[model samples]
Target: MAPRSPPKRVSISHSFTSFFLGFLIPCINAAPLGPESDRVIKLPNQPATPSISQFSGYVTVNEEHGRALFYWFFEAQSEASKKPLLLWLNGGPGCSSIAYGAASELGPLRVGENGVDLHFNEFAWNQEANLLFVESPVGVGFSYTNTTSDLTKLDDAFVAEDVYMFLVEWLQRFPHFKTRDFFISGESYAGHYVPQLAELVYDRNNDTTRYPFINLKGFMVGNPVTDDNYDYTGIMDYAWSHSVISDEFYHNIKQVCDFKELYWSTECNALVNQVFDIYSEIDIYNIYDPKCLINTTSSATANKIKIDGFKRVTILAGGYDPCYSPYSEMYFNRPDVQTSIHADSRGEKWVSCKDSILNSYNFSVFSVLPVYEKLIKEKLKIWMYSGDMDGRVPIIGSRYCVEALGLPVKSPWRSWFHNKQVGGRIVEYEGLTLVTVRGAGHLVPLNKPSEALALIHSFLSDEPLPNHR
Candidate 1:
């Protein structure tokens, strides 16, 4: 594998910064705060059965602005105070959390046959810490915004403000958890969201400038594609090394693939074709998650062997792609999952998948822009992980992200042996650790549930990971 590249820190500022400060802070209660203008709104949500071992609930974050965040809280119902609180952000800049994080992965439920109901997930992350899976930035999932005319543009800064505002309001609603040690976790675009939000919480923690209700402890990101340049190069390299494409094609993509170019050229398309051809031959899962099966276009014809990719590369959000049909020959259909994810939201009884309750804004990378400097300066902990077989934000892409951090490796990369088999590997650095989950893809919690849960548990409790010296 090639050495990872460091992040090219970009400084960006928008006109909303002033409005952000004004709306976020105000004088109130001689206690250094403003009156709570928001009220928690409960939606018509049915709870997961008791046999499922988790709690489902939603707290209104900004009802007045028509922005509300919905979350699934999972816990074993421990009366113990101080249980860890985990805020999970699903990346899409505009994707639904229930689609990827909830139904497909860590949540205690899996989308069943018709996406009509759920099944108990044995490896739910809530078995350890109280986990909150939220559909953020309004217009995503059951979350909504009253103003229909609002621009749907999802940028970094907008997300941070809404997240911070929600956190403050959420803590107020769940006051019992206000002091609990909190960690933010997410994947793909969330790779950027988690850290940026964490910085905001940390900044407010030390300064008398904003809300002090957030008790943020740490953060985690999986298969993050933060740096645009690194992600493109990393994906191509992965495709080439895995024999997913030819060396010739790889060379062309490496030399000519510029992200700024909105669309792929003929050369790029050809390379993609070759890569998809290779992918058809490889299996996406070991135990065979029926969903991971690839579609092929090959048929024994009079002469040439041909293949075609999926008709639509349906990206629900945050670089997470859930397959509803196989490309080409076998168009495997998971209508249930399709309905559950809003991939087919047009079906009768459809609910908005985007959050409409969030404040009107665009995403800004301000938090990350000044993060490493501030956090690195504070000796804070930042962790990154990835499932091996995820194609959208593959493990190789994650490895590349880790390499760019440029932190000295505290522990060299090595397989994390489990039950006489390599489950994953851990690379510890000065203030960060990058991990790879074996036998798991895009959604680790779904493909490798037990392992994903265990990894997160160890991360939260500060336990030394097994097999790592």
Candidate 2:
């Protein structure tokens, strides 16, 4: 491993727009330059507004399917030390990380009014780490899932291979970050992505021949669906706990909802869907649903606000439904989330959540849970968090899995307090940390940005989260 070096600072010649705005203090600049003479430096909240001059060429993962995977990168303004690199993967076998990571999370910009520029996310994750967002497989987001069967039969291993190939070439293209500490982070289905890929990295690391190891430090997942059984069970509990449903409904679902059908047979899967639909329609729990339903028309502005509010609430609830996007929609309607990479005439709406991605392959046969177990046994660090309110895969399910791991409990479960009420709860056992964001649904970052950021910081630093009690 290379020696770790702290970032350096430098003066910027550019005029400032605000007290917060200044050129990246030269520390984050990827441009070739000398380390500054100063030992101490403060990292800016946002890099000075990036000029067109700073935009690097796009990293294209050209495959045979005629669809190309595109990735754009930003380097520190100065190259004083090797910074940790983080690769962000968006869930949805078909969603683009560019939409999630660039538009929403770590990017310096957001999409506004028909793909127009908007305010920067001062808390973007990239500021603290080198970030890479990938659009994977073939038909996902911009990535073209190759053979028709590959598209329909996508599995964890196939994604691991495509991503591995992309990284090998990506390193060849930008050798600078090859040795930098690498970590994988994602949400939703990416719960399966980071671990499978990390296992591949570990395998390559152990093998002296055939493959070379990629320097990977660890990985993180927010509102992940780690196990299918646990996810479904957790959702019901979340619905019940949050009054999305009734305890009776949860008990009834647990009793009558057949897992054998959902996991084993096609007929069973259909039955499970029927159950979810029946439960979703009228608050099976017999409780009033807090979520407000809105149908906006004509004005995109109205739609954006409504959708943003929905996402914010979902994230805060830790329960996710983005609620409006059709489960079958192929492309997101928002221009900012659109992909010039795979914009086809088919005109399908991009889906935020999908059963197709999960059902595409026989998860019953080749689930990545084994891979995560292997990684855990190897003592590789892993962190998993979830939004408490997410119905698809609630934080309760995450807790269930941790309990299944049977790792020695390191910290007693306690409420994570924030905003006058319980923000969520957390427990650390062995080296693993499991967190639930109060009021946050599936997409925690979109909901509780501060808590999510703070969690990521602590995870990245390998430290215990602060006790709010």
Per-candidate Cα lDDT values, in order, are 0.59, 0.56
lDDT of 2 at 254: 71
lDDT of 2 at 317: 39
lDDT (10s digit) by residue, model 1, range 1-469: 1122222333323222232343344334333111122221221122345443333334554555666666555553353355788888887556667666766677665544223335566777777777777877666654555666534444565567677877776665555566678888998778778888888778777753534547777888887756655666667777777656677877877776664343556676566565555665544322123333323223322111122453433433322333421211111123333322223222222222233323333433422424655676577667888887766677776676557677787788777755566779898988888888886776677566777887887898788667842
**Candidate 2 lDDT tens digits, 16-52:** 1231112112234363321222111211122355531
Clash counts for all predictions: 29, 42
In the order shown, what is each candidate's alpha-carbon RMSD? 9.4, 12.3
Give stretches of model 2 more than 4 Å off: 1-67, 76-80, 113-115, 145-149, 246-249, 258-271, 278-367, 415-423
- Each prediction's TM-score versus the true structure: 0.71, 0.72
For candidate 2, the lDDT comes to: 0.56
